[model samples]
Target: MLLRTERQPSAKRSSGRDTTEKPTRGADVMGKGSVLIFEQDKIVRDVVSSTLARAGLEVHPAAELDAALQAFESGKLDAVILGAASAGDGASELIHAASRVSLEVIVLSSSPTIEEAVAFVKAGASDYLAHPARSPELLGRIERILERRRAREDLRSTRQENLKRHGVASLIGSSPAMQRVLNLVDCITDNHDATVLILGESGTGKDLIAKMIHWSGPRAEGPYMNVTCTTLRDTLLESELFGHERGAFTDAKTQKKGLVELADGGTLFLDEIGDMSLAIQSRLLRFLEERAFRRVGGQADLRVNVRVIAATNRNLEEMVARGEFREDLYFRLNVIPIVMPPLRSRKGDVPLLVRHFMNVFHRELHKPVLEIEPALMGQLEAYNWPGNVRELRNLVERAMVLSTTEVLWSVVRRRSRPEAPSEASFRLPPGGVDFDVLEKDLLSQALEAARGHQARAGELLGLNRDQVRYRMLKYGLNSPAPARGGLALRV
Candidate 1:
């Protein structure tokens, strides 16, 4: 029950308005966000409402539980101030109901007890306040709660924006291999703590996959920090990953937080993990296993909630077999594996990728959209993309820059052609060569020369179309050949 205090006499208004009138819904409202004062006692309700209203908050005072619930259900309220007297037998029920909608509920009681407060808090009350609560204290607590809510809303908005920019939707590929990768990403995007290892060759967009996993997942709002393992030596890399205490090393003048520490409640991307030295691999393995690490020369072990997304082009299994990498760490990081296929293996996606890049570059460089030549796609798909998507992106950007006319053409032709093997330079090695290897090399060269035209490739190799096709299948250059007429870029 609330304290029964007499309602103070209304003071005269200088503006000739009635001061005794009750505040109606949506009246005397200001812009600091709305709150409902659900108190049965009119005097207490009016007091709390006036206090909050004076602080620039819109107040909705409800004397009945039904009215309070109706208002709470209909309005965008920052919080609900639930009076125990008004709630009576359904105080806990009301608290739980508000909690289900993520609405903050602050319980007010005349005779506040520790046990009651604990119970209300456990029932999802944001706070439990005593009757005749100090105006400043009540206002302070409400303001703090509102501030936290605003911060969370802001973080959620940011995460949504990042998802739009770096999510799996941004990964453009329709080939079967790319579909597999997308399927895997969808499965793991909501998983917050798994260790993911992305395996692919350089320029295959391994880093892009890492970003997609971070920004599209539950950890989107967390800090995403990436470091290339090959960029630093073992000693410096250790300090960068696990921080250091002051005077830990010659350059450690002050205490520093490493990428792992800084990425707490987020993600840490370790690029080129295969290049990491064996010594550093040991420390990394321990950190992965324990989720704890000590700073250099620091005795205290610090723990962080960070998801480690590691990527590498090197074969970790072979490295482990050769003792260059820790087998334990490989197993730990490989918990969830995503292998990005090389572009040549998925040449069907080349046209789609080319168009995506063209749109991207047009917006970035503010260049007019250039018409693509029909033959360009054929040439692009025919060549073995040693640098993968990154190479393709660069080629598109370069072509857009150098192309003066509206129609994009002949950029592939400008690439330095392989010089023909001359009789003077051709030498049979003293040890002799593998015939299959020589034949495969010649077949690959002829295919490149013909831009993947079977008959044309046969002309270069002095073999018929069927012979060239058979050799191509044997050498695993199994990309479909262009039609006899020509190849056109398809969507």
Candidate 2:
């Protein structure tokens, strides 16, 4: 829970409405934990800091980047809040640094452009809100982060005895992004029967992430099922997902088991769920809310204790805004969200993935991938992986096929961008060419070289007759070519 002693924003302004009448609590509502606020705006900082300090959370607000980071690393903060700044500012970078130390982060800024909001979340911020937020809203957001953090910490404690490295395609990296994801998974495993939404760009290994969650979770003893949202048509999808009673439809000759049923007491991974049709989504939403489902043409509802983990490349919030997805359903499924980072942002993990891939392909295809060329490594790092990890894996395999030697660079087709400008044509001799003198001399020489024929003169200069004439006109160079192929210009 949030430290509640802070003064709630004055309700006296808006029709004398008080936001919170609840009793005061400390930042350590769960225990004795502190909060940090980093901001340069003195007024905003003071108001927020004072409010939190009064709430009993031990709020420490820093007014500069260095000071903020110092205080961040210098203490064990339950959460970090960064106040407002304009676009192209260091706000995102500041959040990133805070992520390394704090379990939860909240950003307070003005209403941002859609791109800015996406960028903020992508940078590891747990949540963002407009600055000068009401103390009630601020406190609510704080508790969410702190509560989630404590949940994760508890989850980690439970996993300490049995938690092991990710199996097969292990997510190998100590990057802050990966650490948070791991922490989220730890939390998921502790809480049973809660729906988890795995949000990320395609090819960020959402499936692998789901498996990791289930394998380490309380449901590890149960089966795991997968349902691709894009594959089935509307009616078929519904019948298939919820199972169909005998004679439910023309093709439903016998009773069938649903993916949800198969996944009972385990985890159900729904991939590309953002594409699921509204009709099916409605049914799924009911199941999520009631913890039970009714098969096609069945009057009775069947209860299942299965964890629903969904993945999608599309922005569900945008879909909801556009009226394509249900807003209520969106909120229900987003209970515990885990956003995966793209491959381009974490270049440090590239080598680890390369080695892991090499070992897998070596045993299967009987080819050794002992070394990668430095040039190729440079190329891989330089290229923006629009397709993310899936593309990277495919490219590595393609390189292996074309490799005669253990050298891996030749298979990489992307060229390296030039490091610096060097071969431009602008630099000339100390004494630059005299435009007038050179024009006259070139006219005379080209006509002579062409034997005074206009067409031939054009050929000598590697240009068309019209092009030569146009240049001559622009340069004010007029030299007549004789019918016998000789021409000259007088000084």
Candidate 3:
């Protein structure tokens, strides 16, 4: 639960040119990072943890530095905060223990004078926080430490991936949805010859799955070809998939190799395979049925060594029923179907995804790591991702670029869901003349349902964001009753 300050000091607004916001979650830092408040004073730990949580960090508090160390090891922390003088007599040993376990250390003092802060920094503390705390600076320090961790891991990963390793293992979270995906990838690893079709909506990371299969497979050393069916014309696609002989078409002035030939001894990924025409599907089916294909405008048949991995956002079964797709070809490609879950379906992955995007944006823009406010994370989990993982990725990337210091709650809140059933289809009762009366009724109904959450309640009503605000003014609804030392949102 969020512990708000009693007798709260109105948070002083900063006048700096840059508007720093609350933090958002960043990349995988290996272990669960927890802040251990070792101050024996209950009030001290409360204040520290409360401050940390307010800044949007995961805090794990212990009264003793020794106990904090134990918890650190037990919880597998990426970093640990040893509250000032809280370690008692074993503070030095505690610091060493932290480094030994590869934990980044931050030493915090309630009354850290200049000398104390310097000494602690010199003594292997990645950060030294002087106790009369400044939320922004402390947040900045934590962000820096996390970024360093990401750079180190990313460097290690780059080296491994250069050797053809599947690297999405760095993506964290023990969500069952993620585990199922990993399991499916494992199943596809041993079946290089078996045709695999990855089915998912856009942004569901079908491309990643295809690459993971290729990189993890026995054919990791071979070429990997990617062809997007939607991006190519039918004639061009045929020439692209199969080699073209000289004078085959106006653009084909000379003999040219196709994706299949280029991908010889490797993996060929056909994205948007459902977009392939029936004629092209027939050719592909023949190749899949008997690993042989003739070049465009050529009489000779050629056999090539390659593994085909097809991905599509379209429902091929529906297309087959409609005669837009060949059922025979669909049967040939469905040898090993791997269906990806949309982001909305995997509630456990939201935190991991937040961190993933955080790390990504922090590096891309060279910004500090930001902690994700719990409130924001909850909002993310509650929202349905109709566009799938791709949609989530885009939102995150945009947030990273546009976000200031805090998680971009405005963007999250501003995001509009797909339109509901059209109002045009629903006729009002006879004599629907009073517009204000109609609006007041709809607004009252929604507000009652959401209990004064303007955003959510607005979604329940078939109205754009502006319309909701305008109607709220038209009705007698307001913000939640204010609580002392908490959010004083405008009604």
Candidate 4:
């Protein structure tokens, strides 16, 4: 019973094509979906029918509310176009009847006032349009409504499929850190339109977290669009987010709808927003404040309803202090901040994640059940995961694809060691080496080579995890290391 409106329609286009013409397009004659049109006035009915038919919709014109209700009860109609001006006292009844069938109802009136339109919307009209309906605008509104309905249908099906594929669980973790993340997700399910900021290191599943929030919210039926901020230049990114009008710039041939407009009534995920330039950040801030923007080089302001969800790996607080990021924009986007804990910080979930990946890859590769060697599991649990979950998934996938044996130890054992150094010998010139600096540099290299796994780093230096931990603390390097003896990796 929600309501939406585009604008008051006009009968003539700038090109002077009569909005009432029966479209000659072959596609229009063979329209794909049926629309039930109810209008007592013959002229208005013909005009509305012609416009709908031209948009490739099959129109069933009815001269009375009873006929329209009968057609609606036939259950073949995708939508209903009601001429409220002609229906008189029966307009509300027809709207209610259509809503009962879950059919999208669009109300048409000869002279619709604000109060009347609001009344019709409250009576269950999905959209309200006043005569004479412009052909392009009317067609566009109908198509948009249909598109949103289809998107909702698709979302439901996809959710069901995901439930099956994901073992009826969206996020997997047993640790208290992970439990907190789940709690945060649960808390945000009902707050569909709030701007959300997701902070996480690369490969910690920020994208997945964003999707979870969108799908769990009330606007799940609406579109979910994402823009990767770091991949495109500032200008290109702006064009992508706020499309340019034809002839706006060089190579601009036609007008395009931006992601914000396209994601109406849905969520727009801005991935890696920290990478956006200051100019783009200001533009985004304006859109958030006003809920409207003009296309690049276009004069008219276009309004759209879209919820913003932003994600980034960078530290915005530090960036703000350093004058690299806008402080005001950060506050606007940080309305509801959800930080994703890095995989290393949730070491207790490593085994669970490994099993999940193993099962997924095994099924995908059509391989038998994977056998984990205890030593290999121990090594995996003890190592630090710099790349987070993504790296772990890649590791499991690579092992599944390359190794013939069911046991994964031999396939992945080599990765546990730090990469070998170059063959070049180091020699001091006239100056003596600074031992403290040299030691810190070696520690950094070993940590990097081991992919931040302190235990493996210590192994490279012929020291234990404890010794590596001590050196890291001495150097002011903070990274999680394997606990005393580390968690036991199951066979």
Query: What TM-score would each prediction reach against the true structure?
Result: 0.76, 0.51, 0.53, 0.60
Identify the runs in model 4 with alpha carbons over 4 angstroms from their true place. 1-98, 101-155, 162-168, 403-491
Candidate 1 lDDT over residue span 140-223, tens digit each: 677777877788899899888888888999998999999999999999989989999999877788999999999988888889
Q: What overall lDDT, based on C-alpha atoms, would model 4 receive against the true structure?
A: 0.78
Candidate No. with top TM-score: 1
Task: State the number of backbone clashes in model 4.
Answer: 1
lDDT of 2 at 142: 75
Q: Write the per-residue lDDT of candidate 2 for residues 1-491, one digit (tens) a residue.
A: 22212233545555566654442455457245578788777888888887776666767778777776777666678888877572236676677777776567777775545565567788888877766767667777777777787877775664443235443226776677777887777766778777889898767788888888887767866777898887789998887789989999998899998998989988899998988989988999899988899999899999988989998877899999989999999999899989999887877677777777777778778887757767666767666565567666776776667654323453244233344466752344555666655555566578767766765675445444544654565555576533333223233
Comparison by lDDT, 1 against 4, better one: 1
RMSD versus native structure for model 2 = 28.6
Residue-wise lDDT of candidate 4 within 147-250, one digit each (tens)? 76667678789866644443215687898988898888888878877899999877788888888877777777688899998779988899899988999989
Q: Top model by lDDT, which number?
A: 1
Candidate 3: tens digits of C-alpha lDDT, residues 35-63: 55566778878876776676556777787
C-alpha lDDT score of every prediction, in listed order: 0.80, 0.72, 0.72, 0.78
Q: Could you tell me how far off, in angstroms, the CA of residue 403 lies in candidate 1 after the best superposition? A: 7.0
Off by over 4 Å in 2: 1-169, 404-491
Pitting candidate 1 against candidate 2, the one with the higher TM-score is 1
lDDT of 3: 0.72
Between prediction 3 and prediction 4, the one with superior TM-score is 4
